[model samples]
Target: MPVLIPTLVFRPVSTQLLVTDGVRSVGENIRDALRTHQDTKTLGCHVHEPIRPYWPEDAAAQSDRIFTGRYNGRRFALNVTGGTTLMALGARRAAAEHNVPLLYVDTDNGVIITLAPDGSVTGEREITVSVPTSTYLAAHSATVSAREPWGKAIERRESWLKPFLEAATVLGQAGGGSERLLDVIRPVCSGGAAGPAELPEVTTAEESLANRLQEFGMIEVARRGGSLQVQPKGDERIRQFLTGHWLELYVYRACLTSGLFDDVCLSVDIRRRTESGTVVNECDVLTTLRGRLAVISCKTARLDHKDENKGAVYELDSLLQAELMGLYARKVLVTNRLALRPPLRNRAGLSQIECIWGPHLPDVAQRIQSCLLPGRR
Candidate 1:
C-alpha cells in the first residue's frame, strides 16, 4: 500500500477584521458573535502578547489586541476599540502591509476594507452599527446625569456587557439556539417552516431576553420586521440552552471546597506579557481567604493535565506560582476528576489539594463561606 503523510504548518500569518461603529455597537456585535460560536466545543478566544521583533519606535510596532476563535468553522479575530484617529490610520497601514482586513467602528456606522493578497483596499463596505438613542445618550452624557452614582454603575455594567455580548453571539450560533427550538415546532405548526412561531412574543423585555439567550447559543433571529421571529438551530442548541444554568451551577459546584475556607470567586483565563519579552497565558484562579492569597490551578475532565514526558502529573506547576505568591500564601489544585501523585500530595510545605465532584458546589460554597468568616477555623 502507498503511504500518505499529512503535512501541517504551525505558523502562518492569518488575520480577521473586527470593528464596531461605536462603543455600544462594538459591544453588541461582540456579544452576538460570542453566542453564535460558543458550542463548537472549546470555543474561547486565544490571546497573545504583543510581539515586537526588531521594531523601531517610529515604525508601527504594536499590533492591536484581538480576540480569535472559531465560528461556523471559519476563524475570525475581532479588534474592538473606542474611536481614535491615530489607531484608525495605524489599522489601515497594518492591513496593507500584513495582508489582513481592517474594520473601523465609528460614531455612526462601521467601515471595513476588504484587502487583496497584495494589500490594496477593496471597495469600502458599510454595515449598520447599533448605538444608543440620542435621548439615552443625553441622559447619560453628563458626569452627574440623573442620579449621581447611577451613571458610574451603568458605565461599569456597559463595560462588562460589551465583551459578554461578543461571547454570546459566538456561543449562540454554535449551540443552535434558535434552530433547536424551531425544529421541535416546525412539523406541528400550520406553516411548513414554522420557525417564527417558536419564538416568544415580541416585547421590550422579550427582545432583551432574546439577546441574552442569543449570547448563550440558545436562539437566534430567524426573521426581523415589526415583530422579530426566532428559531432554534438544532437539538444541541436546545440542550445547551436548557442546561446552561445548570452548567454554571456545575462550574460553581466544581470549584467549591469542603468545611473551612471561604471567599470564592470564579476564576477565568487571563493573559499578559512578561518583561522578558515572552508572551504568557495563565490558567488559574485566585482569591484571598482571610487575607491569605490562594492561587489555584483548576482542571476538569475536559482539560488535559499533562506535560510532555508524562512521568510527573502536571499539578506540580501550580507550586511555581505559589512561590511567586510569597510566604503568606498557598497554592492548590481543584479538580473533580484527576488525582495527584503521593509525594506531591504529601509535601509539608504545600497545602493539601482539594477536589469537588460535579455535584458538590453547595458544600464547596459553604466551606468557602466558612473560610471567609471572621474568627472561624
Candidate 2:
C-alpha cells in the first residue's frame, strides 16, 4: 500500500461569527477533533481565513490557494467536514476543480464518508476516535493545575467511609434531618459541645445513629437530664466524609469506575481571558471519551419549585459558556434531588443537557457510557 500523507487544510471563521452563533465554526472544531484521533497523522495544518468568511468566492479562493500552493503534487484528500455553508461550497468547488478526493464526516454517526472528485459518495466506514487528556485540556484552553483522582481516593478509604456515606444517605432522605444533624455535629466537631439541656430531643433511631457515629470516633456523646449532648471530633476525614464533598467525590469516582472515559479530572478551575478581563469557572468533574468532552456539574442543594427553574437556567448558561470553549462538548448536571421539574427537564432537553438526579447517581458511569457511545449525540 502507498503511504498516505494527511494534511488538514481548514478555515477559521471570524470570532464575531463564533460569538454570535454560540459555537466555534465547524472548521475550528473539526481541527481539534482530528488532532485527537490516534490513527490520523497530520502532516501539516493550513488555516484559510477569508476576509468575509460567509462569502463563497472568498472561501473558495482561499481553498484553491492552499490546494495549489501546499497540497499540489501531493497525494492528499480534502475534508470538508466543517465550516459554514458557503465555506463548504467554496471547498467543494475547489475540490471539484482540482480533481482532489473529497471527504466528509458524519459526526452524528461516527462515520467517515468519501466522495469522488465529482462529489458522489464512493465509500464510508465507522471509526472510533479518542482525545488524550492533555489534548482535551488544551482544546478547552485549560491546564491541569491540580489532580484529585476521586475514584481512586475514595476506593482507598471506602472501608471507613462506607458506613458514613450510608448514615449520610439516611439523614439526607429525612428532608430537613440532614441539616439538623449537621447542626448538631458542627459545634462538637469544632471542639465545643452543647450541654445536654441545650440539645434537641431525638427519637430512639436518631440516638442509635449517634451512637454509631460515636463508635467511629466521629463524635462524643454525653447524656444528662434525658437529653443528648454531642461534640464532633472535627477531623478532616470526618468532615469530608459527612459534608456535601461526599456526593461530589462519589460522582467523580463513579465516572472513573465506568472505564469509559479516556480522561477524567476532578475540581478543574478553567480560566479564559476576554477583551474585558479574565474569567474563571470551576468545574466539578470533567471527562473525555471518544474525542468528545463532557462537563459534569454536581449539586447537593435541594431547590424549591421556583429555585429549580432558576437553577436550571443557571446551569444551562454555565454549560453554554463551557461549550464556547469546546464545541460539541456535552453538558451534564448531577444532583441529589429526586428529579428536575418538568420545565427544567424541557429546557435541558432543548439545550442538549443531561440531568442526572438522586436515583440515577449510582448509575452515572453507565449514563456517561451511553453518552459517549457512537451516534448517541
Candidate 3:
C-alpha cells in the first residue's frame, strides 16, 4: 500500500510576517522555535550564497536565505529576499534540483531546507547527509505551527461557499421586479469591484447574496450606475434610460392625441395646484385644444423581483405621485414593467391619471398613442 503523504501547509504567522517584512523575519521565527525546543550544541545553516556574509553590498543582492538561523544544535532556514516575486516557484524549483529530504515550506518566506532520514535538520546542508523523504516532510511541517496549521486552508474553503445562500435570500426578497433587485444591489455595487470578467469571492454569505442581486434589468442597473449591467433583449426603457433621448418621442406621440390638449409643448417646470392644496413643479407634456392648456407628468419604475406586492406599493406611490402631478397638471405613468398596482388596473378610470403599460415596441408605441390622442380632450 502506498503511504498516505501528510499534506504540507504554510503557517499564517509566517505568511503574514513575510508580507510585512519579507522572508527574513520568517527565518528568525523558525530559529527561535528551534532554540526553545532543541538541546544545546553547535548550529550552522546552509543558505543561498547571496544570503551569507551579510554586508552593505549584499543589501541589494538576492539573499536566498533570509530566514536561515542557527539555534542550539538545530538549524532553521528562512527564505526572505527572493520571495518578493517568485515565491513558492523558487522553493519548488530548488527542491526539484536538489536531492535533499523535502519538508515543510514557508511560501511566504521563500525558504527551502534539506533534512535527515529521521526528519531532523542538523547543522549542515544535504550534501553530506543521507536525506530521507521523512526529513523533507518534517521541514515542510515545520513551516506551520502545531497550534493550527490548517486554519487558513479551512478559512479559504469557507470563503468560497458563502455566496450561494446569500444570493438565494436576496433574490427571494426581490418580490419579482428586476428594479427592486437593482435598488438593493446599487448601494453595494462598486464600479471598482464587480467587473464582468471577475467577481471576487465574498467573505460572508450576505455579501454573496448581494452579488446575486446584480443580475437584474439594465434600466434598473443603469439607473443605479452598475458596471455589470444587463437587460432583456427587447427592453427599450433600458435604452431610453441609458440614452436620455426619448422625451421627444413621448412629446410627439402626445401631439396627435385628444385626451387633454391640441397644441403640445414639453414643459420643463410647469407648475399646477393639487386637490390637496399643494403646489407642485412638474414636467408638462402639454397641448392646447380649444385654447385650453393640459399637462401630463411622466413617472417610471423598472421591475424588482420577489416582492409580489411591489406593484401595489408602486401603484400607491404612483397615485400619490400623480396627485402631486395633479396638483399642477394631469399625470401619466408610462412603464414597460407590468403594472404593480391593482387599483390602477384600467387607465380608463383612475381618478384623473393615466397608466400606460406595454412590453414590446409596437405595444408601447400604441399605448403612448392612446395616452396622447386628442379625442380624449
Best by lDDT: 2
Model 2 per-residue lDDT at 327 = 53
Q: Quick one: best TM-score, which candidate?
A: 2
**What clash count does candidate 1 reach?**
58
- Candidate 1 Cα deviation (angstroms), residue 292: 1.3
What is the C-alpha lDDT profile of model 3 across 153-194, one tens digit per residue?
222444532332233233323322323333333323333234
Residue 302 CA error for candidate 2 (Å)? 2.0
Model 2 regions more than 4 Å off: 1-43, 49-51, 140-144, 147-232, 338-351
Evaluate residue 98 in candidate 1 and report its C-alpha lDDT on the 0 to 100 scale.
Answer: 51
Winner on lDDT between 1 and 3 is: 1
Candidate 1 C-alpha lDDT tens digits along 221-312: 65355465665446542433232322222333333433233333332322322346533324244444333334455343222323321312
Sort by TM-score, top down from the best = 2, 1, 3
- Cα error, candidate 2, residue 234 (Å): 0.6
- On the 0 to 100 scale, the lDDT of residue 126 in model 1 is 46
Query: What lDDT score goes with residue 203 in model 3?
Result: 28
Give the C-alpha miss distance for residue 230 in model 2, angstroms: 7.7
Better of 1 and 2 by lDDT: 2
* Model 1: lDDT of residue 189: 38
Q: Point out the higher-scoring one by TM-score: 1 or 2.
A: 2
